[model samples]
Target: VTLSDLDPPNAYRISGEGSGGVAGYAKGGALVRLESESADVTVLHYDVDAQIGGKLAQLGARLINSTATKLAGEFFKSFADVVSAKAEAS
Candidate 1:
């Protein structure tokens, strides 16, 4: 996942790619708007979902929540690093 062009005091865009191993691969993007603020800021969210395969291929009904959480955390850090580097360059 990645966030870029963080035009501060307003909004940002997040773009990402995901692969579900033998299942499928997906990529998504969304824009986040800062709708409210105080000492802390609140964001309005948006998301997109897309896949590379048919629905019938999903057979199991298992939830790997921990794995998902870990991966998401890693992705968030990576995204932060990428955006930080870009900001530094500018």
Candidate 2:
């Protein structure tokens, strides 16, 4: 069986299920979070816990910011600033 659905921000959740006779039925999903802004990007992931082999089917998500690349420009920097201010006050 196959299922598909649309989420917010143009994200898509695609899922499927299949049986391997002796092995049993397997189910999984792929999700893509598309950015709304022109500078944003689309993030892709596979839902694992919803599968038989939970860990193996899992997809990891990460947010990174470098001199050349950043998913949220200045977002991390602003967050750090807030933390630093709080720490200084403490």
Candidate 3:
């Protein structure tokens, strides 16, 4: 799905491909949840996938994997930051 409805505190299945027009194009996203650990803490559980295909994948698996890894890491970092801020405000 191009857009997702990710309601936290519940597990989910995630997958997608990215636009391949760019050099570092990758498919990257995650299945994640924020579970309350206590009144002051929340835990994130996640499984993430990042893929590169078409001309991007032709660059070899190592290149694709590396690019995907970076993309996924950035994505999760940004996502977590947003979630963390939201939790703190609640």
Among these predicted structures, which one has the highest TM-score? 3
Candidate 1 lDDT by residue in tens digits, 6-89 = 978677887777677767655555565566645443434343333343331354222233344455557656866786688678
TM per candidate: 0.40, 0.39, 0.55
Which 10-residue window in model 3 sums to the lowest lDDT? 1-10
Deviation in Å, model 2, residue 61 alpha carbon: 20
The whole-model lDDT of each prediction reads: 0.55, 0.45, 0.69
Give the per-residue lDDT digits (tens) of candidate 3, residues 1-90: 553655644555566765856564667666777687888776767666667666667768686666666776787789889978997888
Root-mean-square deviation (CA) per prediction: 7.0, 14.4, 4.0
lDDT tens digits by residue: candidate 2, 1-90 = 354576765666656666656544455454545453444323333332234433322332111112212423354357557766886787
Cα deviation of 83 in candidate 3 (Å)?
2.3
What value does the lDDT take at residue 85 in candidate 1?
82
- The lDDT leader among the candidates is 3
Give the candidates in order of TM-score, highest first: 3, 1, 2
Candidate 1 regions exceeding 4 Å error are 36-90
